[model samples]
Target: MATSRGGSNLHWRNSNPATDSIRGGSAQRGIRGGRGSRGGRGGRGGGNASTPKRDPPPEPDIVAHPLGELLQTIRISDLSLEAIKTSKPTDITDLKYVASYNWMEGDAPTIMIPGKPPAWTPLKQPLRLKEDAGTYFRDPNGAQYPRYPAEPAVQAILNSNPTFPTSEIDIFACGSTMGNLLRFVRASSKAFRFSVEVVGKTVFFVRKENSPKEVIENIHGFGHSFPEAYTTWEEDTKGSSSHQRIVQYNFGGLVCVMRFECDGYLRDGTNQVDQKLSSSATSDENDNIIVQALKNTSVSHVFSTTDESLSIKTGGNEVHQQSIFDLKTRSGKYKRDIDMSDFLPVLWLKQIPNFIIAYHDGAGLFRDIRVQDIRNDLRVWGQEHKDDIQQLAVLLNKITKIATEDTRGLLEVYCAGHDLEVRRQHGDGVHSLPHSLRAEWEGMSDEAEESDDSLGATNGHGRSNFSYGDEDENDSSDEDKDFTACSADTCGYCGTCSY
Candidate 1:
């Protein structure tokens, strides 16, 4: 039954103190009865003794100790804070049975030591207790014998599902220490974690089965720029008869490599796709120059042996270098027809010994271009030389421009399939350098395991062991101030809304 709370509940007619006082009632009190004693109560309790009024308990003035000290106390003293922290306190009296409880298992064993100033040690081996006839007792309600007995059915279910399981996160570190540090920071960063879901060491990449309309947009979004190159004709040679050798033209130009490492995870059980999270480093072209150089052979492989002549060294020595570009097709051949766009070449461009620009064609396939390497060198060469590498980068930029502009068209061409041939424009020659000249290495790539996640693409996992601290040790704070959060509408930030 519903009752009307309108007329009688009206303050003017029922509880209006001002009008009541004017009408010969006692002096008016505030709505809360705080101003005078006319109303019933004040604050939490009123003066009426039989009304069963309650008084608030005094709040404890809490002093928190450092985590280490608290942990020591928890281990040494048998004093447990678990009861105080929880609304429902636990009774420690029956803790002897704790060994049988799954919740008792943890990273470190709880050890209680007694002394004037107590000390403790985590047990290397867990304790186990067996119940004998003397230890047996009736159930709390006397409905069953032996207060606690294992339920075989429930135990079976738990065993099948591995209930309350614990896992250890293992790290495999490789690459430069600096790279590893950035990766760790990126994984642990508030901004990166909150915006997207990422498992600690697991990474996933999503490349469209077919090229997207904004494939170039996607690449740039991942923080990479195009490279410049000079116009060159791909030479072709053919002759059924030794007397006649015909030459044909193929494609040639600027080369670039765009390498991106993102912290990500699978969205579904099938792992059909992945959601991209934050990048390990700030979105800067120069950030992964060393990483790109390692992964992209075209960018540096041809000049694999550090040439003293080309290398800038203080004592004049050859700087040996290696690349991340692993071999898939040792001979660089594909059984099925594949397009250049789909073939992301670990190959990139570098200055050749004879002053000629060179690149590891990855068997000279046009589709396998490395974008990041191109962008890194282009920026440096564009800044310093203004004449050589920059000019070449600008020329090569056209290829990417075309690829990006017509992503769908190029993707179609790729799906249809294509082939490239090799021909010699001139005979290879050798150049000698003075002993005083030598090349120096910037970084090294160690063995690493990359996982195949989705879209037939490989995502880098494991840990890297590189030191970025050396690069900005003096001005570490500067690194924090350099990049602002992305302003993209869908961008995920950990806490603050402002990008």
Candidate 2:
């Protein structure tokens, strides 16, 4: 007989379900084992049937590269001046990695390249660098940089100097007004020499340095004095057209003026000067005579005034007067009336020679004269007015200083933006000519030299080159001879020309 098994242990076969069920039933009926025995076997089988677990595979080791780790450890603060100065190995090549670190130093650190000295170094005792207060900087090659990095220095110097007084009169009140005022003052002081001539009603101002003969030849009438004469019935009916005629004279060989008239309409439509029949004909004849006079006299100055006058009425009658006269009357009856109408036309004249004092009444004397002139006049009146001139000069100096400072600052900013190297030259001051003019002169000299060189190369053996030094020497000798020939006590030349 075979051993008996419980129904729980029976296994079904895939091929005949009916046959398996019948076999399972028979096996169950034949089994003699109790529930407790089955239970005990099931527990023992469960304990031994469990699958064993294995440990997880070891994780891959994580190792960082030395260079990468070093880079990661670097910080901007580590690139300080002290760190740079005391860097290990001293060799720049070896410490290139250290230099790679971001730097957070004030201004850009002077990078130390191989074989190059740094601009700045860490002081043994840390200290702030002070800025230079000079207008110029000396470079290694002795070159000059103007209004560059040293603008602050230039400004400091200007500030330290005496300031101009601007309160009494604004030198820059009008375009080119300051320059004009300076010119007038210099002329008045005899610093600039000129000649003035009066011919009839016209006055002429000519520079002493210029050839008077040339000016006389060039003088000619221009623009119509009264354009309305062409169309106005009054002028046509009177058979006279108002016009200006410029004449040249032989005496002194300068320009001459014929007749200067100060006549216009009054508010009530009356002429300033009465036009009597005899006076009118005489005036016409005089105009023609002036044209003829140019043949005999050399006029050096011309005067005319275009400024309008305010109408004045006294005792129910309109009084026609000149603006200059009106101003004088208003100032005081004691004040002399200045006839500046003749002086006002000078401003319009072209080709002004050097040292000439031309007056233009278009720009009235009261409006154009410098404060210094007024002060001078006051002094002439009395000695108590000396302080006024000094005060005015102070104001002018202050304004000039401020302008110079602003100009310097602007130049510095421009140079910095362009990353240009700045250099300084010695002895730059107001007494010297402007830098732009000096530069132009230098450029012209260089061009002249170049042209001479090219000519020399082309000529080779054809011609002898003139010596500039010899020419300059000859000119100086001539000037000396002229000076010795003239007697200081009794000069044949005019006072202006004698100088």
Candidate 3:
């Protein structure tokens, strides 16, 4: 895309009424009296007059990235709030008491969806109470509580154990009612793809391929309706759950697509671990094994591969491996941390492997971009170990394929919002979305889809094959009602809703 338009020369508009209104005026007043000279002399009013002009406020610096896009996705219409009270009074004590009574009784209340993604799920709604729950009634406290019907099917899934089958589950409770409905489909026993609209917002359980045709075709095949309901947000008791907290999925904010790519094995030649792989070594050997693992396993099986050259010899006594594929011309690298802490608080972190897909209505096309920087330290290690070249190649291939698949998946979910344009640039190499990602624009017209024009103009000297088609579905308008933030027609610009 072309750079932003530059500012033009400033031209202040002068508005001096005195010059136009004070045309040649006679010394005499226009008033007519019985006697011509009886009128009092009209005083000549003349003074320099000019309206003072103040400078406009400075524009905020444009720090562009996936974070800004994510923040923009958050809207206040999605939050549901309630009021609470402990005591019941013969007469209404105050507005808080009246509000609490009304809310507890299921009165109309407005929902507020913030523009910021919550750190956890089921974001708490702020409600003020007239009295504490304890003060309502002494013996059998008359305290009121906020309530909603139980989603039985989802509740059942939540009550299960580790190997929960989400095949038909809506675990997110996000439905057509939301902006975009994410349908996560397990393509293989070990790999899955969260499907949505054919635009953006999909997450692949594992990486797949980098071909444009493959990406588009995979997404275009998803069914229209959402699947069954899954688990609801629950507080863990054992403190052993994967998530620190859980909140309801709100469709209003930015839709992100994440994919995992694994290299086959480490390529470092320092150790003779290769002979051991072909030997009678147990699965335990492969558990923490880095470079040598790539040779034996199929590239399609592993999520990410580490390069032998990507190791650091600290103090000349030990070797440390890293998971990053470094590029000479591209702008950055990829991330591969498996631990919850490194990737946890998934919303934060600078080098997490995830793409922030956003739709700018004014622009008429969805933009795909990565949110964080991939680790460079680990990638450098991969480039240094060369003897294990085949393993390194396998690892690179797998990572590239998975990242591309994730880009495609997210575009599908964002289909409800706007048309997608996969940006690619020559020389920018692997870092550009077009080079590293693939996309499918759902429901695009044959003429638009066939034309090379679909590929948006290039920037920084690189070109892309991104397809530009239609805007999002019709917008739903809702101006009144509290408990609900938007009218039933639309989900308040969450991009997840269609009807």
lDDT per residue as tens, model 2, 47-99: 00121011221221111100111101111233233233431221101100000
- Superposition TM-score, candidate 3 onto the true structure: 0.16
RMSD of each: 39.5, 51.7, 36.1
- Name the candidate, 1 or 2, with the larger lDDT value: 2
List, residue by residue over 1-499, the lDDT tens digit for candidate 1: 1121332211121212211221111111111111100000111111121221233221211111001111001110111222223232111011110011011011221111100000011011111111111111111101110111112111222232332111111111111111212222122211110000011121111111110111111110000000101110011101000000001111122111111111111111231112222245343332233224323311100101111111110111111111111111111122232222111211112110011111212222122211111223323432443222222222223223332232111111111111111111111100011111100001001112222233232222122321212323322332354335534342221111133
Better of 1 and 2 by TM-score: 2
In TM-score terms, candidate 2 sits at 0.16
| Candidate with the greatest lDDT versus the true structure | 2
What ordering of candidates by TM-score runs from best to worst?
A: 2, 3, 1
Lowest summed-lDDT stretch of 10 residues in model 3? 221-230
lDDT scores in order? 0.16, 0.18, 0.17
Give the residue spans of candidate 2 off by over 4 A.
Answer: 1-271, 275-298, 301-499
Q: What TM-score goes with each of the models? A: 0.13, 0.16, 0.16
Q: lDDT score of model 1?
A: 0.16
